[model samples]
Target: MPAIPTDAVRVADVAARIGGSVRGDAGRLVSGVASLASATISDLSYFSGNRRGIQPDKTSAGVVLCQSKHQDALPSGAVLILVPNPQSAFVDVLEWLFPRSEPTKCIDPCAHIHPTADLADDVTVGAHVVIGAGCRIASGVRIGPGCILGENISIGSDTELIARVTVMNHCEIGARCVIQPGAVIGSDGFGLINEQGRWRRVPQLGRVVIGDDVDIGANTTIDRGALDDTRIDNGAKLDNLIQVAHNVEIGAHSAIAGCAGLAGSSVVGKYCTLGGGVGLAGHLTLVDGVHITGMSMVTRSIRQPGVYSAGTPLDTNDNWHKNAARFKQLERIAHRVQALETGLNALRKNDEENL
Candidate 1:
């Protein structure tokens, strides 16, 4: 909100780009974007006029994006740019307000690329990056500093690997994907066998195949499969610190929040949303459109598409202890209740016979 605009963006220009009609001060200029609570006269904001809020009437934003139906809802304090979907239009205007810088299209002199690695002309490789043998990097791909790519990997066009990412052997990254810093792709899965009372390593023999338009967050790890490739479908999103185990298949358009984990062979169907801190047990399958709430432990496969939650609600320490104790006695209590019911039914039968 407290903007120091190197140059001002005209309200009319933004409206023209986002397909909105301006109702006030088409010539007004805003320097930056901010929330309604902190927006200044130089900042642009948005109001979802479907909801009633005092912020819309009191906000002093220089320009505002809102629906055409609520043209009269917001006070005349800010210039209104009316559109069908204000939230989506606001994002479209972000390119003009805060444009991203294009990376320099050149391989760094200090980068270590093997002779067998085939890179496109427009690819950008940062300093200290190591590209191993038989790697194929497509056009418009950007590899940030200190990244390490192993053998026979294929990164699709326009994909970006942020600084310090590690992609192991035989992985395929799709186009328009953003792999954040410290992400590990194609890491060895946790596959071990009990051999004569000793733990023996099971060689993970598969690759990780990532589809297009995926956004892998910082520090997320995806392991290689035990036999078949572990696949992440197109348009899937993964948050920071997530652990995807071996042979896991995440379907198209699925979203997973931070700190969630999937055990080996777990499959998540398309359009599913797993909340933060959710855990899926091994070999379980979640159906399409399923949503699991935060902190839930999924012990079995979800057959239907719906919002699922588990774990007991929070209570006082004493009350929780009492409830937990009663849980253990449920089987005995059921037996006693069944005995009383049987006695009452027998007495009722005898009374009917006497009558």
Candidate 2:
């Protein structure tokens, strides 16, 4: 982090930069960005919503990015960058302050590429990368060090495969896809059968089809299907350490967070959001617009569009033990209640007959 600046910037400069208005002191200098808790005299902080209780009042920040409605809550003499959306303005400032590195066009001599591999004019292949025969790498594609591409793989234009990415044979990755380090696509599906207690291997013959503008996070694995292709639709984002099993179909624009697992043959609908550590069972269907919270175990198909959650929060051992005990007796308690209901019905019938 850089030190906070002491030279104050004019409120008109910031307003022109992001097309917003200044609500307070234009002379206050915002030299650095910081949290509301640790902000110094030259630091700038922002409050997104009503979540920050007392931190905004006691902060020493020279400037704050806040909505127009919250202008009166700021400390006296503090500079305000009034905007309709404070977070969006903060993002613009962060991007301006910290720009990303541009890709350098360079190919190492140590990379092993087949003579028939078609690399575009501006492609960059890093050291020790193996591009197999019949591979077509498009323009602006960057293959990082130690990546392995199997034969006949077609990587679309402007796609980037980071270090040690493995794309197996016959897979098709669409344009502008970003595959992070250690991601394995088109791996063999888990298919086997026991013949008289002896296991028999079932070969996976399907391909992995990844659509355009997809981002596969580091160390995620998508298995090849047994007899059909496993498809990932356009604009889908997958987080690190996720597993997509054989023949699974993920619809367009769905976002799955880290450590989530989808079992074989499951069909997830469009625009669905899955939180971290969510597990979807095999052969089930998740309809469109389903939002599952973190650490949920999904065992059945969800047909409606709504938020769903399960799993108990962390608790003390004593309380957890009591809860577990009560949970185990629920079936017996239900059976006893059914028996009592039946007895009451019989008594009511006998009283009617006697009358």
Candidate 3:
């Protein structure tokens, strides 16, 4: 969907939004947001780094957002707005520049809406959307094109489901949630039982309960639990291509980056940050405020709040091979160290007795 574009606003007006003070030409026009290296004369950029080695002199931006410490690095003739936190102020400016618009109020003629479905009067359904029987869609909700909502599903007010979103049966999505394109909620969990040699599929009998202000990224899949519901708490943000397995509970305000996979029944506590490509083993519980670095493998439960990581540092292939070889001799080396310490202790005792 196209975002609502902002018309040109005075530099002073932009500065007022972030509580910043203008250094030059408060009347300059700012119509867009860009980086310092790519900003046009009508666009605003930010200097997010310290003044060290900064070259604002080469930037062609008409306006720059910076902290008060970096004000000395502003180029001549360039307008600078100094704020306490330049990065946050820059985000505020971006939101102002590219505000998201509500989808136009229209239920497309091609949509297949069930007669028993309960949709609010102001709800917008895009083309080819399928709302099953007994589904309830609340006011101000927008279901984009090709969305499929299964029977008995409940979508709350002001929530937006982008194109091709699939919410399977019995799921409940809370208000103000944003499910990005191609996301599949309430999908079957990867559960199986072995009968001799063949595997039998176990029934996934639970729903997915997503809380308010949650953001599910594109192509992410959240599986339905085997017995209890899969729960995502409020203010949690998941990045693209992540896998959240069945019975996994992500606590409030936790942020997970792209390509992270949470195994089945793993519980992540509140305010945790999972970096990209991090993998959590099944059934492990992570305490609150845990920060995991990228590409780390977490195999055990974390009982305290702290940064956790597993995996070796990157090294050259030859060095890696050498280290791998030495790793095999670790037990032998420990035995030698133990024997040396034992002999040294015995010799010291004997000398003391003789003295």
* Regions of candidate 2 where Cα sits further than 4 Å from its true position: 1-14, 27-31, 38-41, 52-54, 344-355
lDDT for each of the candidates?
0.92, 0.89, 0.92
**Residue pairs in collision within model 3:** none
Candidate 2, RMSD to the unseen true structure: 3.0
Of models 1 and 3, which has the larger TM-score? Answer: 3
Writing each residue's lDDT as its tens digit, candidate 1 over 179-268 gives 999999999999999999999999999999999999999999999999999999999999999999999999999999999999999999
**Could you tell me the TM-score of candidate 2?**
0.88
Per-residue error (Å), model 1, residue 57 = 4.6
Worst 10 residues of 3 by lDDT: 1-10
Clash count in backbone of candidate 2: 1
Q: How do the residues 1-355 of candidate 3 rate in per-residue lDDT, one tens digit apiece? A: 1122458898999999889999999999887777776777877889977566657777888889988787777677789999888889988987878777757888999999999999999999999999999999999999999999999999999999999999999999999999999999999999899999999999999999999999999999999999999999999999999999999999999999999999999999999999999999999999999999999999999999999888889999999999999999999999999999999999999999999
Q: How close is candidate 1 to the true structure, as a TM-score?
A: 0.90
For candidate 2, which ten residues in a row score worst on lDDT?
1-10
Superposed model 1: Cα runs more than 4 Å off? 1-6, 49-58, 68-73, 315-322, 332-355
Clash list (residue pairs), candidate 2: 5-31
Question: What is the full ranking by lDDT, best candidate first?
Answer: 1, 3, 2
Off by over 4 Å in 3: 1-6, 50-57, 349-355
